[model samples]
Target: MDTINTDILICGAGAAGLTLAIELARRHVDFMLVDKIDGPFSGSRGKGIQPRTLEIFEAMGVVDRMVAAGGAYPPQRKYRADGGYDEQPSTEGLAPSPAEPYNLPLMLPQYLTEGILRDRLAELGHAPRFGQELTGFEQHADGVTARLARADGTTTTVRARYLVGADGGRSFVRKALAIDFPGESMKMRAMVADLSLTGLDRGAWHRWGDGPGQISLCPLMGTDLFQLQMPVPLEGDIDTSDAALAAVIAARTGRADIALHAVHWRSVYEMSSRLADRYRVGRVFIAGDAAHVHPPTGGQGLNTSVQDAWNLGWKLAAVVDGAPDALLDTYEAERREVAAAMLGLAGKLLEAARTRGDLRRGRETQQLDLGYRTSPLACDARGDDAIVRAGDRAPDAPCRGAAGQPLRLFTLLAAGGWTLLRYEPDGAGVVAPRKGLRIVTVGMDGELRDDGGHLRTAYGFAPGEVALIRPDGYIGALASDERGPALNTYIANSLI
Candidate 1:
């Protein structure tokens, strides 16, 4: 077998794997991304992009394309047996603020989202090696050796300093590691598919019936297709043929006028929530569905998976660059907790869908408030009274550069490195420069001027304070005074 060497080997080139690959590529890290399928995923499975995920994409420099390719979710129109319908706003009363620019979830299909990421990765001079599947991998203290089987039956060996599994729910990597995935499968099943249909307006998400017979047909953005979702009996086998699907729609909606032109993709799934017992095993780690699987009610699965890759990507690159091996442990520590919380939220939404048929998504589903406040890497010299402290998402605010040019905090962070926002009142801080860190002073005459005081208000930091923003766009540490030893200590102890 041919032997290949790389700094990292990433399995399963889905959303998570692609995001990780993009991160590594932008950082100039050597890595390989592989998927079992011959090409990109063609389904519209995960179709909601949350606000937090939009921020991550902005950092990755693809948010513009994503926004252009997608649109806001439409109001859901629930139909009555008499043919009348009631409309409810999908995201009620959520508006974009300076601190949270992307408040509403964008309704884009998963296939399109992956396509955008893949395009960005290709621009970075790399693409996923499809038709190659990770058959097995073994890890040692220093590195991992993985075996890949191609579609043509040829095999190859890959030796890498780290291995990551972004595979789906039936992940071979997780199973091979013997990690316990303990969770109860709900007594509910659903059929989801993409279809070309007629006799319904594309302005609203159309729904019919409730409970076991509930059916939802949502218009997919940027495409002339509707995604169909309906409940199925727990025990019976579902017929996914186009004829059976049309029949089911006719039977449920009582409207023979609605015609199914074609079934683009279809899947039958039983609802289940499961979290891996562990996320890391020596030099190997799991992310996305490999680490946790959730119900699709809250649309958290794909967003959570993308964030998992975002959290792990920078840490993996840092470790490969000779950072302490312990730094990599924080990936599991932070993301697993987030996965557990998101899993519970998804479960609650699933229950609501089952019992009340209430499909209205609230602010909780936006995921803007999720953070690593309790992570070991977080350090806050500021008191607990601080609104935006250590481990919180570094909020964005409109400001001006020294040259009086318009700027945003996210734009400053788009360069992909650690940033220190020093609130120097006089624009004269004797802070020394450090490698791989960009120190931006926020003062009356600093590199960035909080002209409207929006930055101070959003970040909740007074002059003379400093906030250390992680590469992943979270505040790693906060200090009351820039001249204090706390900031340097945090850099030496937690950041490096």
Candidate 2:
């Protein structure tokens, strides 16, 4: 068997793995991504992308493509048994502000989201190897060695400094690591399919019936496809056959005019929410559905998984390059807590559907306020009362550069590295600059001048203060005095 060595070995090619791969690749981290499947995922499994994830995608340089490929959540039209229809909004609308540019959730197919990440990975000079699955792995003091098996009875040994399991809920890596996954498996089964259907207005997500056996047909954005979903009859075997699925749709809708042209993809799954006992074990770790699986009620599964990738990628890169190994410890500490909270939230949403029957999502689903305010990495020595603090999401504001060009705080953070926003007045200080850090002064004669008072209002910092932004667009540390060493000390202690 051939043996390959890499800095990191990522198992599975789902959103989490792909996001981790892209993050590592952009930072020039040596890694390999492998998947058990022969080709890309086909269906729109997790279609709702939250605003926080949109911000992460912006930093990754794929937000524009994703925005172009998706559309807003359509209004829902519930079809009653009496032939009358009732209309309702699927998602609540929020106005965009300087602090929060993406105020609403975006509706894009999950496959397209993965495709965008894969394309960006290709641009970064690496591509996921399909048909290669991590069958087993062994962890050592310094690194890990994994056994990868392909379809043709071929196998290979991969050695890496660390291994991440981005594989799905029944992840081989997570199981092999002996991580305990505890959750409930629902009795009700749902049948979901992507198909071509006619006689439905494209402007709304159409639904039929009520109670535990309701059906819905949602028009997928950027494609001529409709996603059909409904509860499977408890007594009979869930039929995935094309003819049976079409029949179910026709009978449920009670409309002969609506014809299912073709069934492209289909699945029969029970709603379940699970979280691993621990996210990490020695040199091996788990993320995405492998770490925490949601019921897909609030659309938190994929968004939380993507954020997991974002949190781990930078820390892994830094550790492999000689940062403190303790930094890696914070990943589980931070993400696992969020995952636990999300598990409860998703479960509540699922219960609301069962009892209240309200499927509309709200601001909480946007994940904008999700942060690491209590994280060990957040060192706030500013002594100033500010709305946005260390470990909070670094908000964006409109500003201008020295050459009279317009700029945005998000644009300044698109480079995928550390940035120091020095709020120096008159910009007359002769200060030493740190390597691999972009130091931008935000006052007169500085590189940036706040076009409006948005920066001051959003950041709540007086002049001469500095905010240390992490690669993931979170304020890792802050100092009230621009010349203070708090930022450097925090970086040296945490990220190096």
Candidate 3:
């Protein structure tokens, strides 16, 4: 028998695992990722990138490729909610664009998103170990002992200082740790299939709530590519038979006949919102759907998981290399808050569909906000705030360098150190940062600020603003300037 010892053993090489893998790569942390699946992409899953997630990807330098692969535009479209299509596109987002305001949800399939993360991990010189399923784990003070079953019916034991479960809702790690996944499994079931939908807008997303059963038609990368989601009938069985499924759509959409193309993936998912009893149990932790599962109403599943990796990956690396144990606890505190809220928000969105307004009839789930708030750590003057809180993610705005090259605040702030950002060129007169603090100048040309629409609205940063952004991309403070009596002390404490 042979055993391998690694700094981290990540279970489930899906989005959360991939994101954590990439983050560890950036920090030079030694870890291994494993999944039971034979391939990279998974089920008929999530596809929408909420605004906050786009910023995170933009920081990781992978958004461009995601946009290229299958990221779509006009995220909101109308179709019969029960799964037959025939409706015009709809645009209800307050503002959607490509410029500094950074509106618009990036619409790409969930599998493509996972592929992008996996490709980046490989480019960073590591490939996840696939065809391995986690069997069980034993946790000691120093590390965790993990047993895995390989494709060829062989079993191997791996020891790691930490374990992160990214293996989706039915996580083996979560189950092994006896973590309770608490949430409601909804009675309604939704069917998702990626196929072709003609007579739909190529430029916008289409959905429908008017039918007896709620159905949706989403235009994908092009006019010919589309995704269909429909609610199962109240008394319907799990019927995949062609005639019955087609008949259901025809009865709901007033279209007796329709053309069909490739039905790549087809499956049903129950609306659920459940959280682990504890995101962290001893040295074992959970992330993505493993840590928390939610309703898909707001289209936040993939994006939220990516953010979870961003919050946890860096902290895990630091801990493995001898940072304080408190730093690790912060990951659970911060990301769990956001995860809980997202679940609630998704459920609310589903509930909202039951209501209607006078001006816009049949209006349901048409808009989503990139809304985020400040965590206590993001605003704390004390070191105790290391635990991640409800609202914290790096912000982005149209920015230019000293040479006037186009930049986003997130892309340039990954300077391999804690960042101090000031819209002003002079860095809000922040003196020599204690150490490990980087002073980044997000300067404006011949102006103190852009419209409130840019950085201000995206991050709620006011004019003449300055913020101490942590290296892992969370706001440390919002100041007009960094020159304050407690500033130096705060900087020194955060480093060690």
Candidate 4:
């Protein structure tokens, strides 16, 4: 047995764990991410990347590759038992504004997304240790001791300041912690597979039947593949063999003209709308599917899981660098609420899909409306008059830097630290000017000029307003009065 030590230990290398790893790596945090599998996930499990997730990817500095690797959702072509096909508009394209640049959902295979994240992590000089399984872990007041075992029977002991379970729904970490996963066990099950085929047009998402009998084949972007989905019977043993899956597709489509050339992956999936009793137990925490599980409705599972990691990564980095330990407690407080709401929303979508047969992706699924306004970390002095507030997303705006060069608010924010956007000298008293916090004044004669007053309009703030933006691009605190100690207290208690 060997011994290792790190600041954070992440178990599982899916989207959530990979995102967390990339975040910590960029922040120069000492963390280890391990996955039981030998390689990246092969299946196109969660394919829809929501708009909010795209913003998060941009913050992670991988949105360009993501956009290039994926494309917009294809139009839907409905098929009837009589062989008639009805085509529907793919999805509504929302115009990008200063506040919301990525307004439309992106379609990419989950495997490709994970690969892109892994590539980014490699660029940061950290790669997830695959084929390493977390056999068990023990948490003390100060840190956690995790035991990992390799396939050949080699074992290693790792001591870490924190442990995160980004493992799947059947999480060993969650079970070892004895957290209750309470929710409804869905009686419905579905069969899904990725395969290359011939004779079907690769343009639109094809669908057939209705309700539990619904079957669909959607083209996977950036690849010559298609994801086949169909409802399965809850009773009896399901066949996942290539022939069986192909036969089902042929039977469902009522066409012998199509031929399944290659079956890459197959599974019969049962869903549970469950949420963990708690996201944390002392120094050990759970994220992604370990914390919450949802049906494949509204494409919320992977997006929510990635956001969970994003919300947690920055806080972990901050705490490790000398912020208060209580800051870690806010992780559960903030993300648990979001996870619960996501569960409800996914449940509603699932029910609607079953009852009313609605398969369109709407604005609600974009996840841009999620906020932490009700959280304790959100300290808003700017009243309800403003459209934006603390705990809301730090919106992007067009501006010019000190040298008169054009820039964007998000571009400025990616400087890898907290940002204090002071409108002018009126709110200057609240600026503390500390290490790891950048103070950028934006006005006519300020360090950054708000081009066309876009910053003020998008941020919904007047001159003298000071907005403290967190490293995760969320407004941590706001100041309206010139002399209030709220900003200082917020920094001292939560940030410093």
Task: Give the number of the best model, judged by TM-score.
Answer: 1
Which 10-residue window of candidate 1 scores lowest in summed lDDT? 424-433
lDDT per residue for candidate 2 within 3-51, as digits (tens), equals: 9999999999999999999999988899999999998999998999999
Residues 1-496 of candidate 3 have per-residue lDDT tens digits of 4688899999988888898998898778889899999877744378777565666676677878877876545545444446554433232345643333345566777777888888888888999998988888899989999998977888989999999999998888888888888888766667877765445556655555543365655666622556777777545567765455566556655564455545666787776789887889889889999988876766778877877888888778767666677777777777787777778777776665534301121212222232234443555333333322223455556655556456566565665457776655443454574455666654454332353346655554444556677766666665544565555555655564
What local lDDT does model 3 show for residue 412? 57
Q: Quote each prediction's TM-score.
A: 0.98, 0.96, 0.82, 0.97
What TM-score would candidate 1 get against the native?
Answer: 0.98
Clashing pairs in 2: none
Candidate 4 lDDT tens digits, 302-383:
9999999998998999999998888888889999999999999888888877876667777888988888998889999987
Predicted structure 4: lDDT: 0.88
Highest-scoring model, lDDT: 1
**Candidate 2 similarity to native, TM-score:** 0.96
Q: Residue 93 of model 4: what lDDT?
A: 56
Residue 476's C-alpha lDDT in candidate 4? 91
Residue 487, candidate 1: alpha-carbon lDDT: 80
List candidate 1 stretches off by more than 4 Å: 426-430
TM-score of 3: 0.82
Off by over 4 Å in 2: 234-236, 382-385, 425-431, 483-488
